[model samples]
Target: MIKVDNLSFSFPQKELFNNISFTLEEAQHCAFIGTSGSGKSTLIDILMDPERYLFDGKLEMDPDCTIGYVSQFSELDNTKETTVFEYIGEPFIKLQNEIQSICTEMETSTDIEPLLEKYQFALDALDAIGGDDFESNIHKQLNVANLMKRRDSKVADLSGGEFKLIQVMKEMLNRPDILIMDEPDVFLDFENLNALKKLIHSYKGILLVVTHNRYLLNHCFNKIIHLENREIQEFDGRYIEYNFSLLQTKMELQELAVAEQEEMERNDTIINNLRVIATYNSDASRGRALKARVRFQERLEARRIKAPFVEIKQPNISFGVDNEMEDAIVVSVHHYSVGFDELLLDNVNFEIKSTDKVAIIGANGTGKTTLLRDIFKNNHASIEINADVKVAYLSQLQGEMLKDANTILEEFIDAGFKTYDEIGLYLFNYGFEGETLSQKIESLSGGEKNLLQLAKVSASKANVLLLDEPTSHLDTYTQLALEKAIEKFKGAILMVSHDFYSVVNGMDYVLIIDDKTIRKMTLPKFRQMIYDSHFDKDYLETEQKKKSVEMKIELALKNTDFELAKGLVEELEELIKWL
Candidate 1:
């Protein structure tokens, strides 16, 4: 059990949490959902500290309660010569040392009674924390994470995704009172994410996760906590329900404010008319009417509500395609075998058309990135490209674009991918405000940088896109923006992504890359093989409605018809009743 009261935190320039409070009972599964840079991760870190109450808040847990945290940014220490097995049992090893030292000192010490009591307490604590079965638990978790074969593997030799899985499994083996995971699904392929999702559902303790993975949040979490605009909100259900509530509340609140303002304005006009009449001739009736009107205006002023930040929010984004782009096969690969030391995948054959939406999916280390690299190198004879066709690639980090000399707005202008008006359009879609124009490009968050990269490529004359994990660090809202952009674009798309939801909605064809093998199939069969039922009727219909409204809004904004855009956005909000 845990309780937080009036918790507040501040960064150097940004004030993150302001008097936030919440409680988590034992066995309650909750998720902290927020956009990028919303301080959700920072809050989890603060929760791990025993002295967290020193920072203007009170964090209380039942005495002797232990907390286990697996940080998203934690990396294994490669300098240390430790194996996965040894790392998983570190907590148990420390407990063993404490008990050993106590017993050894008790054998020859004069204070035998107190030493004996200390020894007994140590043993009790060990049993309480499941120290006796630590090794067995470690092996069990390894099997679940599909790392049993690598139990003896060195931490330094593991890939990033493998290291992440191991760190999480290690914590699960520790069996603390409360478990916290911050974006544990980040950088994980679909296979590993499925395992993690199952593990979270089976966790018996208090579970608190900070993640933007829509599938994980919706399927594994029973409660939702949202952070925005320096305030915290609690919802009884999952992300979809919370999102609907948020949108509906904003719409209703805006409606009230608009009506109240109109009433106030009309009342002012009446008061001014009475005042003019009173100034001409001070009749008793005129004076009385003016006084009543003034009092009424004061009452309206006292009760008026101002508009909120939600009204200023916009979903404007674009990925430009060549206006003259024609529908034809852009590239064709046949019997492709790519490898250096050993072949990763072979017999990979697929055709990408000018309007095709394809997804490249596979487990970790299964040659997804290698295939992309081979295409980039253009040294393989098994691949063929259409003549006079242009292509562009968006890598994992898009680091090169983020580090450019231009500002966020300047990058698009310099690349000539979009007009000045459309250059700033994506900033708003990615949730960046006008203030971002003056900031350096490197100062943007991962999601913002991803959007900027897409903007740059959209402006090019390329009709084919080869993207590697384009949704890597993006939050759910931005991912939705991406999904809409993908649907509207006329060019062909071939992307390798770890996000299964994005792949399911964004792609029509699926390519499987496995251990030295390649197979092409349709998206529906791939989803069915994975036992996916996430795309139910209600969800799809609501999503289609949202997409249609968004597309209309984007077109109106592009035409610079703000009035039509405003009205359509209001209609979009009204549709939240079905969300």
Candidate 2:
């Protein structure tokens, strides 16, 4: 259990949290969420090591609690040459190795009693970590993550997403009392994402996960801790219920705001009348009345509603084309194959028309990003891009498009922005302010870096866009904005995405990469396949109905129809139970 009281933290440039307090108790799975650059990860850091920060807060942890953590930006060192099984079994392996060494010492030394005691201690340590069937347990965790095939593979050889799941497996198998994972779902393909959901659900200990994946958000957490507007809002319920509570608050706040506006307008009219009377007659009573009316208006203004969560800013992302391609195929890949040690994709072929928006989707390490990179490079013998097409590429690796050594302002200038003023104005739409422009790119949060990448891509003015996992680090609001922008892009788009909503809501069709070959699937078939593979058809159907009713309730609330809204809330409460 962890508890924080009256916490306030800030960087030199800005305040990140103000008077925020929340308690994470036993058996609670809390989703930590907020807008981009809102200090979710920073808070995690403070919790992990309170001494590293200088802040005003009371952070308490139970003395008996054991904690495990998985950071957002973690990587497997390729130079170490560790395999997946060995990595997950590290604790057990160390203990087992010590036990073997103690037994060997017993064979050579006259102090056999001490060596026997040491061997027993090592065996006890191994048992303490549930290492009785360590190898099989490792396999079980890998199977849970859908990475059983990679059990024998080198950890360095796995893709970024796969390695991330391995980290999760390692941490979860350690069986700490409390596990804190920061954005663990980032870069995960759909199946791996599902695997993460299962792992979180199956975890018995306390959990505090920072994630923006809606599927995980909807399915995994039992509690919600939202950090926004320099404050924390904690809810003791599921994410869906928390969201409904937010919507209800928004509805009531909107009504209060409207009434407040009307009252202010009427008070303004009264003040104007009193002013007129005071101006016409030099009566002391008239002047006093006008002063009273003005004071009333000021009080009303102070009481006006500015609801949180309802007014969160979303990045303004719009993709544009530099030149039209005259209705031709903008990109074409034929007989393409790419891999290092093996053929991940063999004789794959796909094409994107001048205005087509297609998604490239597959399991992790199945060559989705590789294929996109090949198309963008246009160097392979089988890859052909139209001569007239101008291409812009967004890499999943943010470093590919950004220089860590440069400031935000410098990066844009290097990217061809004319002046600081222009860059400032442009970056403002993407949520970077004038002061933040001077910060080094390396200092930004993962979501902030992704926003910078999107801002760069939008300004490229290319007829062909090759985006690899563009929504990986973005928050939900930013992700929705990007989806809208992708929907309206007037050019060829070959997007590699694992977001089901992004693909279903924006793309025209999907190019499936399976079994080392590429094929196209219509949107309808893709939707059905997703429902079949990841979710229950009945559950999704109920979810759809729930969404429809929620919208109706919003409409009712907007119209100030309390009776209708009340009825819909009852209906939704019943639906929530089923979900």
How many clashes in each candidate?
1, 0
Worst 10 residues of 1 by lDDT: 306-315
Judge candidate 2 at residue 194 and give its lDDT.
Answer: 90
lDDT of 2 by residue, 354-412 (tens): 99999998988898888888888878899988889889999999999999999999999
Q: Can you write out model 1's per-residue Cα lDDT over 217-237, one digit (the tens) per residue?
A: 767887888776667777777
Query: What lDDT does the true structure give each of the candidates?
Result: 0.75, 0.88
Q: Give the clash count for model 2.
A: 0
RMSD of 1: 6.5
* Candidate maximizing TM-score: 2
Off by over 4 Å in 2: 103-124, 324-326, 551-570
Candidate 1: how many backbone clashes?
Answer: 1
